[model samples]
Target: MLNFVEYTTQSALRNAGMRSVISFGIALLFFAATLVSFQVTDASAQSACFERTALMKHLSGKFEEAPVAAGLAANGSVLEVFSSPDGVTWTIVLTQPNGATCVMASGESWMGMKKPKKDKVS
Candidate 1:
């Protein structure tokens, strides 16, 4: 009968709608779990070297990849030269993956007296 056919079609549509909602919810949950996992792993990470060029420029020198402690994973390139005020003192800035910057000074470089933090106008 026409009534029976109509009922069956409506039931099918309702089931399809429920399935879509369930699928969407499951997908959202999966995405959330993935983001949480990435955050956890990234927080404890030590290397973040994607902006190598910018970091090198900020250090004011060139860097060549070199070995480091903590096995091969911990090793990175060292910055050979970084220019600061005073001809003598060259600050070597080392970039680490864990978003840590380390500075080392060459003994030949003299720090001289404290200069005001202001820049010299051209």
Candidate 2:
């Protein structure tokens, strides 16, 4: 079994990977979308899109997920993380400027982290 510190480290690394995926998705969807045959149909978008409050309610009520981290981008988009209690499951959501909230990704085995302390000098 992993100890708390070790688990936190692992979780942080996994979270970083998730962020990398989000970045890749942004690049693919915004920059190189034309290079690929990717398409966001209205039906697909409708399934994923929701009002911010509604999405929050659904996540909390259905999965017991709560916001773990959230931030706003320069383009007025918001990236938010919702995780189940005990760090077992998680979701990454993006809220666009027009108030469309969508689940960008989700997975299990979320691990919470403690605040990092400054390193000591020898």
Candidate 3:
């Protein structure tokens, strides 16, 4: 049973013709769920969600990723970005109010913004 968000997410991805990317995301989520069941105590591990620590550890270990940025959404959910050292891989995660964490998205070739140089006084 797909929730509204899930249904719409899939529909949007499919409509955008991101079939391969969507397939990869689904596979990653399933794999994460499988690993989480063994690593986390959360009974809801069947839904590709788990404790933040467990899921983060898996992501960090698998992809060598570390948190780079985060912010609170209007709904109170915290969104975080984890990126690999080489900037070749990244994942966006959402932590719900109930403490459940799930991968919202993942991809490769992620680059961060560059800081502007300061002007010298003449």
Candidate 4:
């Protein structure tokens, strides 16, 4: 009787151990899948069309103030638009966080109008 009980207990423990390991493996697989999905989404999001109308339409009303450099300078992995001194032409560029600059689009006769300031009531 004693030997039978010991054998049964050992078998149960072994089975429980196997179950734990399998559960851990499944959890790890799920975690890896989530990471891969995020990476793919991130890569796709970073991609740009490099077309004029597409870029202009996407970047409309999203322009931010950027500083002028001697030749050309950009920072961050975001789309940016720089215009000529007369504001008649515009150049769209993508600057990566690693300091890489890619000219996405450029056009002549580009004009942007500033929004009218709202009168404040004191």
Kindly list the per-residue Cα lDDT of model 1 for residues 29-84, writing each as its tens digit. Answer: 99999999999998756443435556556545443322222222337634444544
lDDT by residue (32-121, candidate 4, tens digit) is 999999999997676444454454454443442232332334443666667656555667677665655566666666576666889897
Candidate 3 lDDT over residue span 39-109, tens digit each: 77665344567789998899899999999999999999999999999989999999999898988888999
RMSD of each: 12.8, 24.1, 20.1, 10.2
Model 1, stretches more than 4 Å misplaced? 47-122
Please identify which of the two predictions, 1 or 4, would achieve the higher lDDT against the true structure: 4
For candidate 3, give the lDDT of residue 103: 85
The most accurate candidate by TM-score is 2
Which candidate number would show the highest lDDT if scored against the true structure? 3
- Models ranked on lDDT: 3, 2, 4, 1
Q: Which model, 1 or 4, shows the larger TM-score?
A: 4
lDDT (CA) for every model shown?
Answer: 0.57, 0.87, 0.89, 0.65
- Name the 10 consecutive residues with the lowest summed lDDT in model 2: 35-44
Model 1 residue-pair collision total: 5
User: Stretches of candidate 4 above 4 Å error?
Assistant: 47-122
- Which structure is stronger by lDDT: 3 or 4? 3
Count of clashes, each model: 5, 0, 0, 0
What candidate 2 gets wrong by more than 4 Å, as runs, is: 1-47, 119-122
